[model samples]
Target chain A: MTVSKDDKWTEKKISRREMLKLTGVGMAGVAIGASGLGGVMKAMGYELLEDDSTTAQNKVNFYGPHQSGIVTPVQTHIYFASLNVLLTSKQELQELFKQWTPLVVRLMNGETMVEATTNTRVPTGDTGEAAGLDAANLSITVGIGPSLFDKLAMQHLKPTALQDLPHFPKDQLQQEWTGGDLCIQACADDPQVAFHAVRNLVRAASGKVEIKWSQAGFNSFPAKGGTPRNLFAFKDGTGNPTDVQELKKAVWVDNGWLKDGSYLVARKIQMHLETWDRTSLKDQEATFGRHRDSGAPLGKTQEFDAFDVEEKDSNGEYLMPDTSHTHLARKSGVQMLRRSYSYASGVMSNTGAHDAGLLFISFQKDPAQFIAVQNSLGRMDKLNEYITHRGSAVFACFPGVQKGSYLGEALFNAL
Target chain B: MKYKSLLSVLVAGGVLMAGCGDTEEAKKEDKPATEQAEPAKEVDLSAELAAYKQFALEQMDQFLMETEKFVNFVKAGDMEGAKATYAPARMYFERSEPIAESFGDLDPRIDGRLADIQEEGKGEEEWTGYHKLEHALWVENTTAGYEAVADQLLADAKELHALVQTVEVTPDLMITGAVDLLNEVSTSKITGEEEIYSHTDLYDFKANIEGAEKIFDILRTKLEEKDAALVTTLDEKFKAVDDLLAKHATADGGYVSYEALTEDDTKALAAAVNQLGEPLSQMGIILE
Candidate 1:
């Protein structure tokens, strides 16, 4: 499926009310309150509302109950940007989201941010780097950090469950990489597409926001296809909940303005490849408590075969070592969706060591689910010796946007 | 003394006899061996390499002394004193960076920045060096929490001083080290990423150029013997870079804060460095 240039030109003329009607969301559904409606309405002038392109290949629908990139099958590449808001008021923040709504929709539909203009004297509307690329199943997820509330004086609207992650043992968090007022998680099958989505969005919002820190990451799948291996060569994301019902229970927030929204916890974990490479295959397998080849539990044969962490051999020894990463994580008795990617930036200038690690991202209904599991693995997991947690952030990702409404409209309506 | 002179003359005659024997063998091959009649003298670079090692050791010694004095000011909670010493202290390290980087892990332990440590996925505790203290003194505006960092900076400086004596400086090292010094300036120092908080990047910038020039000076005679035009171009280019840097120099033999430079100033400096770097990169190939 492909969208021709002529189709995009006509779609730009579709009015907001017409767009809502086309998407089956009646006028009655939008309940933007009186207090912040003016700024949101002003932002409406800039909106380029259009239906998701059905003809576009590998496209994810923009309108949904929950955001894409969370439950959407993991993409091969990600370009995550943590930004600091330069705006002052809550109304301005709402306006910024409203402004971003249609731009994001256009990006997911595999179209440029706006129609091409013949005027060559000025800078182009969209950065043309992603011109020849498809949507590549691109997903853009935006979330507000805990600090954003205090900055905008909207602490009352902030979720009680949304806060920064507590420092765990062996955390070497650097301030430059740690906190941010907002974050953009752009993922796509093609890295250039993912990076282009972010680059264009950030450029569109130039002075209003600045990137505090960002890391680009990727995953390589086997030719036949399966779970991808991390830098340590162990299959990752094996324990993620696959059932829709389980995903809903584990991930989606159920109440308040944040209903259907989930918490995102991002950790910049630096894996010490030099140390891991020196260990024997047996010891390496013991570190993750999974076979390096098949990604199975120690006593299990298949990749997905489940086994009890407490189950012991005839010798009364636990099959999975009590100190293994998977064992402790399982012992926590909680789950979250792990959507992570590996990053190899280059060598560290001083030590000549590879500057590589996992950009560990997880989605959960509450941040506590992630916190509980991390606490369980605290200091005791053998994996701790080979990894260092260098950065951390938690953000309350908004629920998906319905037609005629903007991103985070629920928060503004509650205000 | 008379006996030693006689022994040296005997050794010189034996070397002459060996050369004649090689020339005779070449004649028997019946090829046009006119060039081999008097064997072309090999340019022995051993003396130059030894001279470069001595210069590097001197730079390391100065780095240690200045770093100790700077660390003392930091540990005493003297903010102004520490800030005053900071840029001057880093000058020595910047000058001797090639030799300092030769040792495994020592360079990073003593000179690593916050970003460097972050890249290694290590904690803030692992970050110990001049820049770490530079952050506390300049950005944070206090030296209260960096007591251990100050002590470690001194210890690492001492280790670097001890390590320099053991370096087996070679011709390749001298050639490459010159290029590396110029690269350090063009990449980080020009951008003001180094000395980010203090804005004293010009100090390090000048030092790197000086270090690279020292290498060129030692190899000047050998370089001229091969390519005299290249040697002349290098001399002029080096002077151009030095002249541009001289514009930013302060009365105290220090440089103006990197932040004080206008966009035009930086651009001109960058142009001069690039001009020098192109000709300087050829030194290795010419020598080989």
Candidate 2:
């Protein structure tokens, strides 16, 4: 998978205008060999590194101050994969990242992982499932897990805050779903595009890594478009940190090799739909501490209307039940950016119940923010009866890649 | 049965009325009437469904005995012995899963994987089943802490066996049960996810196929009467799947470890199961 350092295209810098023109021509059924596409990409990579072009249809940039998927407005779908590293050395791991950087750019550009090949004898470089689809706002974020540090013998470089989460009460975590060496959180408006990004990336790293466990999830927005409702029929992500300053304070780390990067906490929470469906509508609303139709705090009329968690009614009873999910979470007084997707894989074969839930993902400066909120939910959150934490993982997502440099370059430089 | 008989009588009356019309028109109507009457000779499925229930009970009987032996091995802290008996004991339950699943919570308690309980939003402490012991034997490589789980597994198996006797097997259960059994194979068993640590998925795979095949066998005579070509297709597809599975069989009547199969072998098996599944899924509609 190594690209030769002395390749002619690696040295040739092309202008964005010229590169777009050439790629546009190529897109119109021009026959380019696999190597030819690689060369063209190397040249285009240098030009597109500085700023994201507004011209590309529904595209997200590969290079930025922070990773794309973290605060990139929630997409319609996510294909999150946790991978186990098979590589033995840190140098080999570094090489794999270098090999992936340009490919990531190509996918976000709505281009195939590699150009279409005329040779039918070999499997296509790209799986070609997402062919002819636009970029669909695809964003790929990569992160390193705690186990990867030990595997590569670079424990000293591991972040102090990045470690396995403590077992929360009632967490029924499974080994297969828990930890991973690394993670790729690919999200896009189109399900196939999100899936294609992860598929091509994993395929490229074939022998070097394998998916430990992966889940595909989605969020369906209303026609008017607002916070998408989870499977529980409550508008989620309503309380996420939205403003730039709040995002900086809560999400992006400000120091060390991880400056501007964030810690990603992923919890695979399975929501029992059958039980929830049996409950009354009023109970469902009380369980979430919000109106089921308006997504507002209890006793409020609008989804974003402010209300104190401790607000009491005229009768001196708390308006928002203290045991409610939102009340407990707000009492923690910490916030993390929630970018979650709901999943409905199929029914449980034995009981004929739905096998569905939320792929709960959050980004925080330190994982303690998420931990504090989860601890606040604790054993008493009314929502616990309908949900279980099945899988959990935390990863130190790298700061965004810079032009002429690859992913995780800061960490390697520190070493 | 009453509705069908009434429908046939109405058709016979319509045919008699046509006999009062012109001779050529009556002759034309007579040929169509006989064609309609052919289906009126419908095979009664009650006896076949009853036979299916009996088969389910027999499987449950064998399941209890095998589970007891497996439980005893675990209680004695015999890792090798428990591991050896684990998948074979599970085979009986897999073969009659549609019947066992009908009983409330028993299927999950006896056969639930760790993920299954978690998906049900249950706590880990509530996970008392065969896979719990399977994890202890294979992953932990010690049955020392699993004596209680072993006892619970046997008790659940016994309860399931007892409950099977009360299950009323309708034609719908048999028809959909056959399709469900095949689906169980293609979805999880084919991926070797059911027995993650033990890698004895092939045993469960074969058992599910046999269970589905048993239902098909009982319904074969009636199905052939309705669609002979479909029955032929199903027979050929089932044989194709069986032939592929036979290559992986061991002399001890067990199967090769699921992990031992190559990528190509797994794909080939998946393809065969899918081929069989297409025709098998139609059995319900065809029977209706």
Candidate 3:
């Protein structure tokens, strides 16, 4: 259960990228290891700086009936789908970004506007153009690539080569997609929306691009949304952070490439429990390793309060069962920043039923770290027996603040 | 008795997410990470992007093909072609239904329309005979009953065909209109006047265990193609479940038994179902 040196990076507050920018380039990752930002830069192809410049955006959305569908029978009204878009890229890297900026503004529902930063309060309105924005429930994310290359490499505004791909350059011309592209984090509210968006997107890509294969479903999953979000009764992500708990940054702007800005995005295909109700509450608690009364691990009462493994009796043995939810979560060394929502089956009758269950979501710095948390939930967790895995997909987003500069998206062809 | 039948086929075949909206929804819950690169001294930048592009294209290509193949079966009337194809289809579904449950926010109208097919059994000819199958899918969500109704419809269609050729009767003009029913179905989400079902309704949030059991039984007995095509699809599906099981299993093993897994994980008391149930169902078909 011991974490690697990468563990400490996962615990920082300002985010290693932002810190790197503020601390000065080259000096970034100076204290870290070979496997640290510097080494990862060599293997991956990125640059890192601890500066004060604006960053990429993180988008998380909720698509389902406008209201709750778990316990109420309100016809699962207000059909809507929530999406979480993440953009991880470095700005000041791309050359012909106009074609890309318009698309980002349209998708994120924000407009290019103007205003002036003041001496006191937070700034109102941007400094460039002027207009209104409409990102309904959509959120576009942007994150600074944290790779060692990104930490130390100079901005890849120079020419680069992609001789590997047709129509690409061989001179190492910068901005040929050394970062990422919209396709890397592209998606839609519906299948047609997605298809159409991607069609327009690839047409926009005039150069060579390299996309991560693991994110094959970057445009799929959620398989369905909106009214379908709450047909069943189980609440998903009930324990997730709500509107900036202890983890949120103090200020977040939504303007220009950031109007209607975002936080982070999480995705999961939670198993439904239509047939799970047959068991007793006691049994159910045992399955989740947490108690139903307070949503805490067995032996603990408070919901959000941390589980006290040391709360033992005279015998000096563990208080909460080691196999309990909180115990295992702690032992597994992963935290659930989860935020779940339910979806309803489009059709249901007296006998046959429709689909319904939780769409569990969470966010963290490294997928591997979050993975550790999810793994604990997998092992000996009380909920395991009653639930089964269905679908899975992953994405890497950037902290977006500039138009057309999505993480990895801009560099999709460059690297 | 809750007669058992876990015969669940992928509704509307299997739709693939073709663009960005696909990523935005799921993107909401993840922590964004920026990947970096090495200085160009030794690494071949062009070679790298090239290799990555090939891998991406290949995977996307396979997924699209698989998705299209599944949907075409239904629209082309092949879903009912093999009775046994239904079982493996159910197995794929039984494992998926729970996760599909997230569509808790669906409009009952969509499901209601489909439910009417079974309850009233009157919309069969009224919904434009030419593309009755398409209507059964888009308007009614009758995917679960296609097999049950195909036989009856086949007989009816044959009789209609004879009457037309012999001049005993005129062909139902409506049948001719079934022309682009599939294209229509595909565009239903876009052009439909009313807000019926959304992408969320597509999820199987809950398990229709009873429905799945019924379908699997039939599929086990009659699916004809035991060859590579059938085996491959079935294998990929099972692999999906196996991967999930491995990811979610408890550390000590014996994670959740099939029994535990079957019960609604979200509830404290799910009902019991019969071990086996009758597969006989009165289903409908399209004339076109």
Candidate 4:
């Protein structure tokens, strides 16, 4: 991990672009040899950089039974954009998806969207901002919104449960950050890498799509990985399922073109910091039904202590208040894999409150799981007082790719 | 968070200085580096601060008068008048809320929401503020037990008026406050949730915009001298939002009912707020 800039192993591991530059190989030769280069180099016993703790340098596998970003370890940064499809015809939309697949693959492999072309008069194939950088563990997850079905005239193919979320009590949802025809969630260890992934994809879809709304979010990485905190300084995503089997039960969809996929529920919850900041510690703790410092459930000393909504104190009062966020969420018994992150655009210009909140993202096998939990929290959750659900949307995430197939290939084929 | 940021900056500066030391040492061994960039000019903000102080005081004076009127309406048991006057009265407070909020416990006492009190597990006796008056006027539909709270509100408004005269209106406050006003609208007011009980968020929204506009007005000359293009963009954006807001204006100049607004109207206003906010946020950095 501490390998110096001039290390021998670093020098030996020549990138494909570097290899082309050194050998003066033409584009055809490079393209033909692209898939086999790693295998060929391995067979020739050429030792490159060791597969170790270089998380930022390592390339994540884009093709799998399920998308990488869904259940993969949460990256430090994310640039999630929901784009409205400009193309009306199914053919054009499918073509855009087809064009995006190879680019997504190249980016995830830590390569530029396309190999650099020697045409000075024309624009470069790749944007070149990420030219000198690694892939930074980039993972791009594409999703289809409810409106996309109308555009493609594929309503029959839509998932049975794929629909807009119900408006909850106290929801002041803004339209701009609400819904879109399609969404791309890009996550990476480096912020620039995550942003670059979305930028290139959006650029590639120039005429076919436009950004409906986007939110950039981040999670601070402690030396040891653990749950991150929301803008309210409370540990969020602590209850998320980490086991693969548990994730499969709670997240992966089982039918249609979305098989092995998941449903993404994104909510832009604006935390009322001005009011929350004025709140007493006792009230704040009561609102959460957990200890702020340790993130432990009331009447428990550890963060992971099983939450008992019915537990009582010496005064015969409920230790975990029924209205507390944890109590209501726990009582609902609906499980989803939460992968939320905090975001702050800046201090809102209208009010002095910090324009910050959790970009609450959750994935489940069905949207009902998320809805059930939200419904449980709708009218009674004490945390509701300090937060507003300002944005809401649901997207049907596509299943992962096979070795040669591109993203959402099954959906394209079905259409 | 501020301490952490400062520490990080110091650490980064140390690293940069160390790198420069090494490079300069090498350069001295070869030849002295030529053509260093000129230092940036520093601008004085005393005049701006003085101007903002005057603006804050004037705003507070009007806010005091309005709060007294609201209190008087509540005392007279004029429920409809109180309801109608509620949001407009909040305008003065909203315009200079950042400065008002600068005084610990003042804003909460005067403009705190019902959730603020209820969340704290306090009963009506403990909940003392405009929101208390609001709940009484709207929810209870009577001002029976709010007499004491009314007097207290009037007293607090006067306190705010006196306290504002001595306020130090720094450039950072104006810059941050301007952006904060926009964020306030985007976060809660635009959603019509800011004045949820009364549905008078339109008034708060207008006042916040006016407050932000006032800051831009005071700093316009300075900002223009620095970045004329940004000032021009802000001017167009401000006009765009104001033009849209004008459609909702009543005969009395206050906004129409918050419930009267359509989703499209809110959307249009929010877009304009963002359009203005993006460039307005740059003012602070420029001033710095």
Candidate 5:
């Protein structure tokens, strides 16, 4: 526990083959031999990364110009946790982020979080739930909330665009789940891997932060891989900004330490499944103004056909109802990158209805972009009948990692 | 009628004798039967249905009376009075909404939110309900050009009363209604956004709880027979929630503003509702 925190880089960087030669650890007996040599390296703040070429398909690069999770192709599962900073000092927060960087790398590379110790007296460094699992293309994204600045006395460093969201007309936000000081979003094709990332991260920050709230979500991709439907069974992310150029314009921030970072707006929108299940198929289609089965715009043949919001029907009515969700969202004209997933938490304790809805996540250059769309969604969208906005938050995601430097290192050094 | 009753009794006796014949072999073998056969007793649910209908009709009558008062206040341009009357009037309708919603068109005309009929920016002409009146009283702060809607609201309230009289109530409907009432409140009212402009969601919340409680009260005797423990706990939970809500009642017996309740208060209410909801859901299965 009293080991030096920063000594690995000073020592020689040994290749895995040399390390294995120096200390006989092979693929078959790797688990048994982990405690002997790997434990020592780990205690010295180094975890050996073997060249396992088979894992090439299962790993996402941890160091990039932009974080991997945001614009990376969406994963099948997510574990999003918003934490309340328990540490009072900025240095503590900075050190925690530093410690997390390599662990994230190891996890994404499908390597053990820490050396496997044969010692049974002490708690295992890793939970070992994902022991035999591959990485499954895991990505972990970290972010800081608006309240974090005040806590660290770094309010002057706060992004101008990072503010608490304004209350919409129909918003009924729950206090317990609404706000946090920091957030971590972990995504993976495998649920266990996703949960493992968040679990170990939380474990690593044992005394520095406490989970304010967390939600587990999942998505089912078509065999050919296409847009997935939300709990409402409508194709979501249909109109998201997908191109890197479009992302730069609409998602990635362009100034300060957050130049390559983006703002995340998370909303826990609860779908009233019981009520929705009772509604007629026609009424359901009319509510979203899309054919539920095809997910096409009203009167349109293709799902991706541009919405003709103003086109008139034979009856002189708008082809899509003006109060429809897509029309209003399209009217806002504020494009953001959506990476939402559906979630179901069994029956709501009070209502006896399915506690399910979209864990709505969107990335943008500024929170104002999301606010504009939400303002447009204010009381008039017919979709409001079957859904309720129960929780909301805003966070400024840290810029991508550079090798040898940790997350948010630029911002901390600037100060 | 006497002759028919006698004939049915004879037929029932014949079936009972035939049922006894199956046991003759066992008696001849001197094998002791595990238990004696009990006569099948008929449970008439018509009395419960009639009582539930009467209760719904009575609640509608009160709803119509309140709507009349609400409309009068709107017509006189007494904005404050109309606003005060708004949520209280909604209580009667919300309490009997399961039956009121049986009339599909009437429910929308009477309780539809502004979102139901119009676009985001445009004023809605087709919308007419408690919410439309709410918007006029709270958001617009005037009742001008709302006279026709007020008139129509009263007409609908009366129609709902008449319509409810014709609705067929069954044990199953009562059970479903009890569960749905809780769902309705938890989904919308508990958040205190159902009456967004007026902040009068507490009235609706209390009404919905009481409405669900009414069905429980009607069926408590039967439920006690099936599962006494569940009935006992549900009764206690309802009382606890009602006691919590009682703290927010104004001097005139209307609820306090939804905004006035503290976060702790809201959480306590939610916790209580959840406690009652679990057992309330079990009612459907047990009654079946």
Candidate 6:
């Protein structure tokens, strides 16, 4: 609701105690007392001191720099999502939108919409010959999935609950569920920001909604100070291209463009709990392209250790197996930022009747860059079969996040 | 602000990570000597941009008309519609402004919208973040010139949607997906884990990608409408982008521009753009 160049928003640099305060999880803060806190602080490269208050209340986004992430983000979004139960009628939807009007007052700490005298300054110039950044805008879409309906059926003990869920032939299970098929898309400048917005939204919809997943979407690199558009765990995308073809030209029409600069990748990651658990400590490390215990390269225990492909075995072959998951990932290209996530869909029938698995999603500037690594994985990938894909969506990432705007809006605009 | 490369952002972030983590003790990691190395060369990214210049003028026309329309309503005291479109319009401009960042110095039309706005926070719901254009469309009713041109942008967006499936199952997607799934399980705070995710949530995402690829093949090689001239340029572009991708990709995974961006180098940019780019504001989105 407030916007100012002064950047008065207090940088929400959550400390160990703050995280503990937010998640209300373990004694992470308590155990890190004095020296412990100091040790943790040492690791983070920050002094325990911080200024909580702001000089002016005009800045909506926190301006302080963080230890990690791009200091000044090209793209920054903090989404706020709410999972509301589907109203059977359009009239109800309209009413909800109406409800949002009055609620902004409560949601924004009493800030009211005002026609201000001060004008927001903007860049005024010519749009040159090159393609503009299209990823400035973002959109929210809603859909009804069978699993959602099944969950609803389960809630109300609906007789046709089983039919609603994707995994339906179980006649007995079907009769005991309340079907549902409505979902919402809430977003903003960063996943962290989205969390705030979504939290408030869901809170407002408490009785009228049955909250589903409220995830921080996409693992991007820090486009803004919030979340990485390519949030590859273990810091992927240490290398990538800065420029590709201009947006105005066509790759197909353009006769002379570099094939090396762009990339495309697709992967299906299946979680391996049963098989992974069966493996010994060393075997587990081998399965993942990295050390399982330390999340490091195959030969090293330290996180973010430099990978040396030349290290060899007695046979003069590479010490790290060529077929190792890590090896394939390395071979394709380093332009990838691997931000990933996981899911567990209750328990399955002992016979594995369930089709539950991982939904793989990866983003790169060019699809071809990740294609080589993908080809290496084929069906023989170290972590295959254990994970299965179900729902998939792809978005051409726009340039980056812009201050005082939502993600991907510009691209959506021209469209 | 010109568009800086993602590599630049990541490289900049790496240097900033000298102090981080929740525990006070975790904030003090040893700063490596190499971490202090020189950054890449800065480029005039805006000079490389391609925006729809005509679209800006059209948007402005619409903005004026819509403003007049809303003002007329306001004059008549039609507060609801005026308020209804207000927030949406404001949010729309805010959201759409970032696209100009990529055009560091290239496009003048994009620069215009980024630079000036008569109103700060005003517009409709659906129009939020794209206020400039949406205002032009609703209030100004300026689509006389662009009603036809809009099909191009819409068609391209659809094409991007159709192309998501051109990618298939691979290690990168798997690694990325698995990581995301794990994060979901670990961080979910909905109070009832039982209700949030079904087995389909796990597998459906990959299934959707697989399905999208099938759709891509039809759009690219098999579509009857694909050879219809309008999309013919895709043939050359895809091949070029594909080739450039293979060359610049890394041995350990990451963007190729990583080196150039951190060191302020534009070698990768020039090489990639010259090798893989087209001059038409190429807006391709892929799903794999």
Restricting to chain A, the TM-score for each candidate equals 0.90, 0.90, 0.43, 0.86, 0.90, 0.42
Which candidate order results from sorting by TM-score in descending order?
Answer: 2, 1, 5, 4, 3, 6
Q: Provide TM-scores for the models.
A: 0.57, 0.58, 0.32, 0.54, 0.56, 0.29
Query: Which tens-of-lDDT digit does each residue in A1-415 have in candidate 1?
Result: 1112354543466754464354334222332221121212232344445668889999988899988899898889999999988678988788688778878988998998765633332235677899988999999999999999999988999898988899899999998789899999999999999999898787666446768899999999999989999999999999898898998889999999989989999999999999999999999999899999999999899889978999999999989999999999999999999999999999978889999999999999999999999999999999999999989999999998887678899999998
Error of 3 at A234 (Å): 7.7
DockQ of 2: 0.01
TM-score of 1: 0.57
Count of backbone collisions in candidate 2: 0
Where does the lowest 10-residue lDDT sum fall in candidate 5 chain B? B33-42
Local error of candidate 4 at residue A25 (angstroms): 12
- Please say which candidate is ahead in TM-score: 1 or 6: 1
Q: What is the C-alpha RMSD of each candidate to the true structure, in Å?
A: 21.3, 18.5, 25.7, 17.8, 21.6, 30.5
Instruction: State which docking tier applies to candidate 4.
Output: incorrect
Mind giving the per-residue lDDT tens digits that candidate 6 earns over B121-172?
4232212122233334545544334332233333332332233223233322
Q: Answer with 5 or 6, whichever has the higher lDDT.
A: 5
Q: Output candidate 6 Cα RMSD.
A: 30.5
Candidate 2 C-alpha lDDT tens digits along B1-288: 999999999999999878767687767777966675775333368889888988998998999998999999999988888889999989999999888898777878888899989998888899988889988988898988788888888888878877788899977788778888988999999999999999999999999999999998988988776456558878988898899999999999999999999987997788678667756765653343
Model 4, span B4-84: residue lDDT tens: 999999999999999999998887667534423344445688887788788888888888888888899899989988887
Error of 1 at A158 (Å): 1.2
TM-score of chain B of each: 0.84, 0.84, 0.21, 0.83, 0.81, 0.20
Residues A381-414, candidate 3: write the lDDT tens digits. 6555544443233223333433212333434344
On the 0 to 100 scale, the lDDT of residue B274 in model 1 is: 71
Each model's C-alpha lDDT? Answer: 0.84, 0.85, 0.32, 0.80, 0.81, 0.32
Interface RMSD for candidate 4 relative to the native interface: 19.3
**Which segments of model 1 are wrong by more than 4 Å?**
A1-44, B1-256, B259-288
lDDT of 6 at A304: 62
